[model samples]
Target: MNRRPLPQIVLGVVIVVVGVVGLLRAMGLVDLSLDDLFSTWWPLAIILVGLAALVAAPRAWIGPTLIVTVGLLFQLDNLDLLDVAVGELLWPLVIIFVGLSLLTNLGTRGTDDRTINSAVIWWGSARRTTSQQFEGGSLSAIMGGIEVDLRQAGLADGAEISVFTFWGGVEIKVPPTWRVQVSGLPVLGGWENKTVPPADPEAPVLTVHVTAIMGGVEIKAGD
Candidate 1:
């Protein structure tokens, strides 16, 4: 069973609620200030975005977990519930996260594994997978970028890659013989597929499920 992404479901509900609220306000049935409400609860949106990333790509958890943590801190501070200043502590945390990611090879590295799990945070990564049996993988870019070349890889049956990009970008290069299917929810972001499928009806298919928040994802055929 294919379930809808949590982020997409939450977004739809939020949009409906907002529309209903706006209608009620216009009808004079309710008195409310959306600007003030948003100002107070804006951090929740960040938290949800992080959650969306986390859910979309669970293998790449560090970056999304950091995002959620930061969002929580901001939310607490916004409500005057935190003693320390978030701005003062965020830079050091960012440094630590970057260091950890680099050390773990999750931030940047080349892999020939059939299944790849990669996450890049606050930095850039370039990976070329040469796996003969290319399987699905999870890739994430948080305040960073990742370029993955799968042109030399071969897909067994059909493969699916899950991606999450928050304030970052992801570029994927595949062979022209593969059939590309790109589908996902983009929150203030977008994704594009530029791969040309071969004429064979049974051509290998590559399905990409992406959640982009204020970022972009591009899949194209390699030269």
Candidate 2:
């Protein structure tokens, strides 16, 4: 029972459903077409993705929450339930959400251990990790950037760093002796790992799990 497998499962189901509907339509068994269905209900997909992200990474809820909000607004507009245009209300709602997120620390939680939990919204941030027992931590950036210097940190075992970025970037600097493994989804965005692995196969590993939407992440070895 992995905590993050639901997203993948949901994606698989969506693909299967689309294929089945397409096949049924081609056979004249269904009146609805995929294009029409998607055009009318795409916002629901965004909301579902956001919900999955929340389940996948509860601590990094800032991006997911915003996504859910946007999806709801779009859906409401599609249904003609609002008095004003969604475009007119979107930015104001975003600003309000950002304010609330700042006050609530964007759902980031502090731990008693040396685990970094940071959130940057509409601003840039720079931090350095010097923890001797660096466990993993979560980092969230929305409409901002975060530069984390972890060269001074000593990883006793392995570490897992979760990063969520929306229209922002995150740069991580690691020690050359460490090995880096990065995995995650990026929508209209990407990540780059420029760490040259040391010859020792037993080098400590640092795993980065990221969710980036219209954002980027870069990791490299630094002094």
Q: Pick the candidate with the highest TM-score.
A: 1
What's the lDDT for all of these models?
Answer: 0.82, 0.78
Q: What tens digits encode model 2's per-residue C-alpha lDDT throughout 1-223?
A: 3343556578668879989999999999999878877888889988877776666556677778888989999998888887888889878877876676566444433222456766778888776767777777777888899888888787868678888888899999999989998776655776899999899999899888777778998999985
Model 1 lDDT-worst window of ten = 102-111
For model 1, the superposed segments whose C-alpha errors exceed 4 Å read 1-6, 103-111
Candidate 1 residue lDDT tens string, 76-180: 998999999999889988887777666556432455667766677877977788887888787778889988899999997668888888899999999988999
Best by lDDT: 1
TM-score of each: 0.83, 0.75
Clashing pairs in 1: none
Query: Per-residue lDDT for 161 in model 2?
Result: 85
lDDT of model number 2: 0.78
User: Which residue pairs clash in candidate 2?
Assistant: none
Deviating ranges (above 4 Å) for candidate 2? 1-9, 12-16, 19-29, 55-57, 76-93, 100-113, 156-158
